[model samples]
Target: MSDKYTFLTQAPVHRVIGVMAIPTIISMLLTSMYNLVDTFFVGKINTQSTAAVGIVFSVMFFIQAFSFFFGNGSGNYISRQLGAQNTKDAEVMASTGLFYTLVFSLIVMLLGWFFLEPISILLGSTPTILPYTRQYLGISLLGTPFIMGTFCINNQMRFQGFTKYSVYGAISGSIINCLLDPVFIFGFSMGVSGAAVASVIGQICGFVILLIMSQKEGVIHYTHRRISFEGRFVKEIIAGGTPSISRQGLASVSTIALNSVAGNYGDAAIAAMSIVTRISMFIFSVIVGLGQGFQPMCGFCYGAKLYDRVKEGFWFSTKIGTFFLLFWSVVLIIFSGEVVSLFRDDPEVIAIGIQALRYQMIIFPACSFMMMANMMMQTCRKTIRANILAASRQGLFFIPLIFVLPYFYGLFGVEICQPVSDIISLIVTIPIVWSAFKEMR
Candidate 1:
């Protein structure tokens, strides 16, 4: 490792976290840009088409949640092993995680491809939005393996403290996605399929680049040698990573629940909710990116038994993430209507979307706490607690809130559910923070 990246193993907590987080933040922002760029192109087609993109987000997140479960789970374990000077264990974790991701993604692709119509319908596809949803989902599903594999590879690299390479690979993919969006969507008149195709192509490019670079960089090996699944390795990976999986997996579930509620108001409501979600995600991605940057430092410090470093890393990451997100949420709140209108010009959709976005902005900062806390706890192997909190934001709390809230407040309730759950999760996270920091300090 270079002097700069030496923070992965040994460095002052603040500096180490900074070194690790910048690239991750860039990568995460770039990742979000892929979605935004696609949203921009899809928005040109009409409100229904734009909403189709949002409709399919839950399915994508579903696939991603599983991939994250294994990839992040394994990566977290591997990082700690490396920190503990268990290189072989780290290798095992890497190989096992990659294999698991490939297998899971292939299965998801098959299911999604075969049942595209029903799946889309189930994901909140209104009759007007069904065609666009199917078109985007069909092609996007085809790229599931590539997307999931690339995600796994990136996580592995980040955990191994090769974050610069991870950033480069992701940036390359984002650029390709951005460049291809206009070409496929407009130039070829493929519409939603065009967006899906562009996304897959980008993921493939990213996977290839990371695979080759990983070998050259000696970060991890992708060899013809058979990778045997060790039970212990799997257990360790699953335990450490389950929190991430629950966080993302539950997010997928939460999205579905959110869509179901939005569906009650008709296509316009679906479209409106979609725009609101995309806008919120655009802002939230930065916070997530920064938190991801701190993962390596947290894991390494925990592994090295540098408890003080862990506390310092957690505080710095939380402070910076909160500050950035607070500023963005304010901006989003101020121009909430404009932001919603950018995705769909339909008057009714924009009206609902503006309301949804405003509520989301109000709850945005509270949401950050659960996210950052989960990252810290999971990276340090406090899996069970992390998983509970991770599941809270979208799964446990969101499911009930979305269901019950809509009954009382109707559409407004549906729009406000996520932020409410986020607030609840944030409140719950306080004790986790106090105890974690107290112990570490």
Candidate 2:
């Protein structure tokens, strides 16, 4: 198909974007629910179990950062190659990415299993939470390669503009996870460990689905024939992926910091914060879904040197994401207590979570802008600004704010730190946005 006839080119931008985004959004929402399921099941075991789930959550994010680093980096290159009509290059990139993800995930899985204690502690596990954390991490680690490979293939599919198929893989996993959670966690009385096991099984199933899809679509080749690694291509992938690494990596740090800060308030506070994070993430997934829809469009346009189209995609995505997030944020702020109480009914957990949720909601719409900007930059291979903005929200900007604000203002400060950091990050993004606009024009 000619550029003018392509889905990214000829279709009504808004309708086409929605067609691309809705499945991705549904997938994101389902994935978010699994995290909620983690909390819900673990919460039933006791608050400590819930807190343990929270600690292990950070460790999982750390693993995902690496996964995303390769998945996104490779996918970005492949998308551009496709746009440039270099099919062979796209396959090579996808193959190399899969190869790397498998190796990396195996090493991580072994390390997580062998050093569960230290790993849990590093992720901010309190001594009381360590046992549960270890069990949860151990189970999840067993499926690390599957999860990592799934993400890599899913990214490739999305880059190829096969967003619906990517959604199928994610939804299949999430539905299985949702179905198994109660059986494993309560029916068998397996507790936190069961929840982790359910997640592992779900990820493996999802991995199989994605693997089959990739092969049939010819997106990735699992050939025995050796493919020479192009040093420059690897470098490009790393460079392109740096933003995702920073975004997710800093998120891991933020999770640890948030847990440590909440720990000071007691296990109830930790549990409440964990629930709040899950709730907020469920909403944030919509923003991610829309941003992802914009990614391939931006990449393809940029690759084709259609700078105007790239600019249009960025702005249009930003508007759509902000509108949706704004509406959701309002609902969350209005129903903060109800949302928190859904996971755990404790009065103390509800009280702490309400405040956190309210503050987090205030920043949601603004943060959507940052998401759009970052995704656009990544797709266009604008690495430096992308990484800086990506790292800001979680790492440099939020970490110190979280630490210092909590000390001075108590629990309220801790709750407010994320929103504050988000606003500041958006401010920093303004210049990058302007520069991109000027360049594109």
Candidate 3:
């Protein structure tokens, strides 16, 4: 047994969480910063070009869905195995996840390239935006394997309690991407294609870094011999991973739905909504990083049957996450227009985005509880309950609301759908979390 993980089971809950979360928070913030950088540079193009990136974002979310599926699925299992002192199973899970993610991502890349035009159209790109979308999406898909592989490797390292290493990979990639964004976009005159190329190269850097780090002693090591295609191993991955897949997959679906609905208002509306989504995600990343910091603890304590510690960590994380989100929500509300203007200066985009951003912020604090509940369930291996909670926010609620609300209220309906869904998901989360805690008791 490694002495490194002793703190997870014995250290004070708050201290353990702080140690794990700070690096993740930095990594998440940097990741969001580079994404904002992408929007910043791409916004310098035209509104149509900005809208094109918005349209392609749904496709990017789809790719991320699968990457997270494999990463979290195997990561969840690995964390518990390590907790139970089953190093052999942990290693197999690691290898299986990386191997399968590579194969599946390659297949997705091929399919994405083969049907690039239709895929772009399907993501709600208008005729004007279609050309830029193709240019960006075509190049972006080429890095699917690396992006997916990086995600898997990062997750495994994180679950193994090697969060600093994960941070190193992620921060390095974001720094590289940010540096290259301007050079490729302006210096080389590559435009949107330049941004896509920079992104791919950045992902490649992170992937390489993570791959090297994963091989270090006391971390999960990937080797050809550990790869397994057996049905049982695959089932375990699917069981553990389904929540992530459902959550991310629903996000992709909801984004597509959002883009399509917003498209009715015009390309400006789509662009405005895109900026709002990016900014909201940037703010929400802090909460997510905190939740992620709590996840390995949940897995380890649960596996070790330290139920009290699990519960303690959950509440502590929730309180901290809520406080930070509330603070940011106020900041965003106060400067909604200015924030929206930072991305694009169009009067119409600013008008649409300001209202949308405020509406989303109304429920930002609720997400702390919702996310912690989901993460707790997932880490504790309550797969079905986790999936239900995961799917509800975007899939069951947001999807229906997106279609239905727009019918009655039009643009306002579209803007408010997410906040409404978030509120209801929070309502649903209370009982689910309560029940899980009861089980632990």
Candidate 4:
């Protein structure tokens, strides 16, 4: 047995999870901070600027949808391969994922530039927000290949249990983004365009670092030679990655729907909801990071036929994730107004955001469970169950709710839709997870 993952197969469950999860949590927090920072600096320009960034976020979601599709899909398979002592297949999967991600991202970038104006309009950009939206979206689309590649490399590293490498890439990029946001947004007077430039630079930086790290001898290396477009490899990648595709793809759809619905009210409504969404994601990153930490462990254990260990890791992650989310939910609930005001202090923005933020916080703990269950299912390659859970929160549940709730309750319905979806998702998750546990038994 290779010393690289003997610890995974032998270490105490708590220690294994902690060792894996902490770096991921930090990486995720840093990544989420970039979005918050962008929102903050852009918010200083005006509500329209902030709202413009929000509109462009739908595009960002689209980028991430495909990125995660490849990243998680390839990463899951690589982890299991490593667990089964198949390094050759793991390398092939890694290279294959990176190759396809770059290719698809290029397609998205071209398509985005081709329909830049129409895309902006479709994303819910108001007339006043269009110029800023165009500037941000145009520059951002240029970095799509780099952004997608970075995410793919990061996920590959994490699945190989080299999450520290993943952190190096993510944190380095976030730091660059943070440092440049002020420089470009105000120092150079680039406004929203500056924010986009800063973001692209940061993503490029991370992409370079990940590429370097992936080249190390013992780590999962990506090579052009290993890049195979063979049908079997492609099928496996899609099969393993379908859950992430559905999850992120639906998330993009939901964001677009939310933006369109919120746009009806005003830019303030869009900005308010946008700020709340970024803040909620910042808090939720901890849960996601923890869940990611659990992923390789689950993948490794399940691949090695250590079903009991997989179950143990799942429950352990659930508890830790629950506690962390509960704690943050309290903090967010208590300081909802202050938190929203930090991004945008306009009274209207703050008022609209605070209530929505609190509603999200109310059901935040439920998200921990749903997220954990989904991660476990995905890691174990429970495709159908995982895809169902992945699609439920944002796609299956939230999509319809976004349309229906706003009709009866007006703006408040829009505000509360996500939390309501989250609660229902939790209910849906329990049975699916229970069934999986029984199967493990």
Candidate 5:
């Protein structure tokens, strides 16, 4: 434990974040593949199947919100506790976070089963896409508890400076999902349902591997006996995690709103937009990976009251993240049509998706700063500022624009909504981030 704390505090900021970012970057890409792999295989079956997976992705995001809420929330507290040499509190938080994540995810699964069809419709499923969406969503519900649990544990593990396990666990599930996708979707003739099954199986594999990794030397152990329901422990998790949940939960909401708006054009529009969103996320994983790496270091430095180190790490990561995204955005824009075509070959889908993808890519480089700032704020316990920035992209800006923009520009409005939101959110992020750094001193 002492060794881990020393590494987080004394290690050179660039070297430490680099060591952390490598595995986390790979892990984030693999995690995104959980959706992209399914999208890739399901597209072969038909556009409706592709659309089904996309529609159900909102539920996956919502489930992930719980994981982030528990995982990141607990992780922030755990890293701080370790920094302060408070081992007992760290153990209790590890167990408590795991226990609650399992319970909450199970509840989500049960509630989803009762309202499956309504959710499918609400998530922008057209009549043709309804049946396929139901099949995919039904099987996906069964895996919620496991996937959410894995996500929580993964975050906990990364926060401990054991990010190699995160990469390994993510790789295991991604490989399994990739191998199983074709076999189940084609060999078993299961269609969209098969894609969902592959994802669930992959998630279960990840969950099992992560559980085993948690027992590794120098890592925190999760046990029921250590679980705490005390207000102090609970509040710590809430304070650290609220920003993550706000971001992810509102992502689900914004996606649902985007789909509903796109539906007016046709199922083709829905599929195109869905593919575009997935593509954007895939490219943006680099930023998320960097933020993940920055978080643990930020939390530890702030906890130890090495505030200058925390500030330096944030700036270093933000610069690196923005550069990487800038490079990728240029590449993606140059080949936007082919990128969208790789997911689905339909002329209409590709055409609509290309425009959306290109527009989003234009603003993509700006998101890195937004994310790094939010993570820094959340780790430093600047909850209100962090939550506002977290919610700004989807909830504060995107949701309202989705409804208002279409009235002015129709289908073009839907295509441009997210980029416009990113711009506004980027503007809002500057003042909040500026205020946060000032408050930290």
Candidate 6:
């Protein structure tokens, strides 16, 4: 066995996961922080501007959905192929995934520009927020190709355990975005358009840097020759990646539903919910990082039939993640108002943001297991169960709740819908995870 493969399959589970997770954690944090930075700066523009940013998030969500679709699908397959000592298949699949994402980017950008205004309106923009939404969403659509490409390559690298390079790209993009945000927004006087421009520039930079870094000795480099149109490769990608697409695609729709419902209350409600989503996302990014660390290991150990190690990695991550989020919950809950105010100081915005933030945090820890299960199941190639689990939180549950809660509780229902979905999703995942472990035994 190759030294790297042996280390991955046999290393102490904690040590392996811990080492792999650090860069990914940092990458996810920096990426997530950029969104918060956008929210923080745009909040200063006006509540309507903030609401516009929130509405555009549905577009961003869709971008990420396809990116993760290629990323997770090819990534999971690459890790397993490498584990089984098949470098040629891994190399081919790597390029194929990126090739697919670029095609998706072209389609999204074309359709997005063709129907920009109507699309913005469909994303739940109020008349007051529509202009800003168009500005932001226009810039977002322009950067779709670069942003989605960056995300796709980053996932491919992470699954291969060469996260060392992925972190550099994430850091570069985040730093540039941060520096450019203030210059464009306040210095250049571009308003909402400024944030969008800065963000896209960063994605372009990250995409370039990651392409360079992927050429390092151990990482898989994308080559056109390796791009395969074979049915088997496509099937593997679908099996592994469908969970991400399901999770993210539904998340895209769910955010649209969320923004649509929040708009019913007013711009303030939309702005408040937007702020809460950013803050909660920042916290959830850490858990995702931890699960990502576990993923390669899960794929590797399972491929090698080292089933016990796979289980160990899963439990180890779940325990650490639950506690980590639980601790953050306490901190965020205690300072909910204070944190919400940091993003936007409007009294109405802060009031609504605080209530929504606290509601999500109340059952926040439960989300750790749900997320980890999906990652684990997908990595192990349990497609059907994983897809079902992936669909539950944002799709089957969140969509219905978002519509129903507003009918009964008005704004309060909008605020509470997500956590309720989360609670029920956790319940659904318990049986799936148990059965998976039983099968492994």
lDDT of each: 0.82, 0.83, 0.90, 0.91, 0.90, 0.91
**Candidate 6: where is the Cα deviation over 4 Å?**
none
Question: Could you give candidate 2's per-residue lDDT for residues 1-441 as a string of tens digits?
Answer: 244227776566777677778878888888788888888877777888988888888877887788888889988997888878777777777778878888889998888888878878877788888888888888889989988888877887887788877877788998999899999998988988899989999999999998777666444555535344779778977988899889998899899999988889888888888888888788888888888887877777778787877777777888878888889889988988887887887899999999998988887888888998888888888899889888988887999998999899998887898889988998999998899888885
Ranked by lDDT, the better of candidates 2 and 4 is 4
Task: Record all residue pairs in model 2 with backbone atoms less than 3 Å apart, i.e. clashing.
Answer: none
Candidate with the larger lDDT of 5 and 6: 6
Residue 178 in candidate 4, Cα distance off native in Å:
0.4
Candidate 4 versus truth, CA RMSD in Å, comes to 1.0
lDDT tens per residue, model 4, 51-89: 988888878888888898899999999999999999889
User: Could you estimate the TM-score for every candidate?
Assistant: 0.96, 0.97, 0.99, 0.98, 0.99, 0.99
Tell me the tens digit of each residue's lDDT in model 1 across 1-441: 334235565666677777777888888888888988888888888878887898888888887788778778888987888777777777777888888889888888898888889998888777888898888988888888888888888888888888888777788999999999999989999888889899989988988898877875558685535365768878877887788778888888888888878888887887788777777787788888778888887887688888877777777777887777788889988888888777777889988988888888887876666788889888887877788888988887989999999999999898888888888888888998788777674
In candidate 1, position 412 carries an lDDT of: 85
Candidate 3 Cα outliers beyond 4 Å, as residue runs: none
| Residue 396 Cα positional deviation in candidate 5, in Å, after optimal superposition | 1.2
Candidate 6 C-alpha lDDT tens digits along 160-220: 8787787788889988998899999999999999999999999889989999999898888
Q: What is the C-alpha RMSD of each candidate to the true structure, in Å?
A: 1.7, 1.6, 0.9, 1.0, 0.9, 1.0
Misplaced by over 4 Å in model 2 are 1-5, 217-220, 224-226
Cα lDDT, model 2, residue 8: 73
TM-score of 1: 0.96
Kindly state the number of residue pairs that clash in model 2: 0
